[model samples]
Target: MNCADMLNNLDSSIDTLHTRTKLSEVILKKGISKKDELIEYLRAELSEAFDCRVGFWLQGSRKSHTLIKPVDKNSSYDIDVGVYLFFDAEDEGLSASEIKSTLKYALASYCEINDEPTLQDSKNACEGLKYSAFLTIDTPIYYIAHDNATPMLATDSGWVDSDPKAIQKWLTDAQDTDDKRALMKRIVRYLKAWINVKWNGTEHKKIPSLAINILVARHLKQFEREDDSFIHSTLSICEELEGFFKVENPLNGQDILTLTYEAEVFAHEKLTELKAACLEANDASELQKCLIFSRLFEHYFPQIELSAFNRISGLPVTVTVPELTINHYDKDDKHIRTLNINEVTVKKGESLTFSITNKAHFNQYCSAHWTVRNIGSQANDANDIGHKVVSSITESHQRGAAYTGSHTIECMIFNGATVVGANCIKVTVKPAFPVLRRKKIFKGFRR
Candidate 1:
């Protein structure tokens, strides 16, 4: 089916897996110091003005770890800024609208979503809240909301945060090259590299919200350290994710976030390949991981010998686990086929019985093709008549024995435009009994 469906199915099939808390202690990360400096200054002003300890902060990609993203390998751009406010979820009963009105009153003419308010909601209702002021670049101090915690800005209203314009300006600022965003991106890259160098040595599960990003960044660096042949596959993943995120060329070429993801996913594969690359790796830890990956590749990517089925015994045909995904639509178009007659041979007057199944029916549950081909005589022989696939058989059927001599019969299958296989059956017809039925217990006849 689809990814969503697969996820749903998997969830239903397995017991709930308890996800341990990933980040035990929250550490304010680098890459947003400039933005943070301005915001913190504002928070101090507002807190002093309103007598509250609530602070305006940053989160998301930056808070998770790094600040400015890696330089765009292809070009340069501004950073993405997200703001957060620390507050208890349950301290107030004021409606979201009231908070927004208060924020607008405090910070007039700020850039904010007029059509909708930005408010972050949890499945569970929250307690104690602190709101943030929105700032247009022109008016960095214009406030928006107060006492609300969730801080993503929206067109109308949601969680209140710093003005989008103000944040965007800081993101584009060129003078402060060593600011938080750049530093964070570097830190994330280092973390990722560290993860790569120390996969088994350290447990990644203990890392922060953006620990995986570290993994991605490190893996990307690995692509640069190793062989050139893999450059494209890694590039393909980078481009693919870049396209997925709709990142610019410069941004895309500069980092390995997506490639690292794919690498980690196929971590077993890459690790195994790296291990086999050389026996001279000085690090025993790396060597051990290399061996682990090698074993994984051997186990998972084991060569699959895809082959067509040749038996016609009505026995259900199935491939092995991690089985081959095969299509038999060579020139012809079909996916699944059913067993049929005419080409199905039995001894003279011998009855043949066959059955069909719905084991692999997916959505839509369309139909299957059942045909009998008689390779009578030879290729293109006149006696060799072929029956085109006509109907979708749901169950089994018995066909009276054939009157013709032995012939090769095949039951072809199809699904949509793809062909599944052609199962062959050999039937040899015996000579018929004499038609004299005068109650004769003739010789060679069992009474």
Candidate 2:
């Protein structure tokens, strides 16, 4: 394999391991739904308890889709929810501490009434709701400015002006304007996953998610090639970190390095290690590069069996091809048709499943790799276009609604370490059908 193919394989492997599986996605959605319900209940309860208006919105990695699964299955996940109390402090003679106390009281009352666990002690910025050992919600109380609609957090010191929405808006705008934003997000997740995998049991403060986002957004260098861009952006940020370890808040231009000196030192050291790994991978052979990446990513990287190939022989090996089949399904979970040709047309939101059958009579092994590439006229990054699920020799993918144009799904069957057979199918996805609501009719009462 050449450099491009090697990099493609690496990218696919990382995506397959790092991206959330369909079941995990469903679980996450359910968690978010429960959190949303809790937030709504809190809004109403606080309003009733304090005799003031209250509202809330989400502001964190949850909104940005950069959240990664916990490295350990038992580890906890947190969602940051900002609760806004819409009342003037001076007019109502309410202090920051008073507001926080009132909010806590309301939350406690809510827990008691709902027969749920009470929140723990309030942190410097927020109060935590412990749903389980593996899930928690952090709600920070804020006051909305009547004049300008700015949000001020209730802190121990005093009410401090802070608008998380501003940062969210900045990220949204940056992603919308840059064509390479999807790649940037993936790189961010990769870095986060690396941190998770490497420092699973370490006591040092895990790098803040916001800090990684800021660094990636500020230092990412766009390139024509996806792998080149990933390497360039990661190396660029790592090099910059060698000079200093401060991450500026995009909203207020303030340094948010709250970690201790020892933590900072450890962060710099880890970044250096990452930089070295990237450099080594850049200079190594294709297979060697894959091994280096596997080391860097550790358990999060999928394992590829390479013992069947002999490095000492240094001779070409012929492999047998495996029989492949493609099955298509509609949104309603009904089978649309079985595809025999290399091309098919379907509406958006349709699903496709690919399966492989080992045809070798004996003494052969089969492993399959699948990838989908956007062949449309206006393709951004093909890897970022659709969602795929890879399970052993079988792979499944669903066409996204926004992905209208053309795409090609390719499957390569490997007999041991050698590519034995390859096949691709072209997909022409038409626009999704729009929902239409029936007009309501009213009976006339006129005489």
Top candidate when judged by TM-score against the true structure: 2
In candidate 1, how many Å is residue 295 off?
38
Model 1 agreement with the true structure over 107-189: per-residue lDDT tens digits: 33211422222232221112111123211111111223354322333213343333433333433342244443333343343
Best by lDDT: 2
Please list all clashing residue pairs in model 2, or write none if there are none.
Answer: none
Taking all chains together, the TM-score of candidate 1 against the true structure is 0.23
lDDT of 2 by residue, 269-348 (tens): 88888898788666666555555554555434433234332341222355334345667888776887886667778777
10 residues in a row with least lDDT, candidate 2: 380-389
lDDT of each candidate versus the true structure: 0.31, 0.65
TM-score for each of the candidates: 0.23, 0.64
Number of clashes recorded per candidate:
56, 0
> Model 1: runs farther than 4 Å from truth?
1-37, 48-51, 60-86, 89-91, 95-447
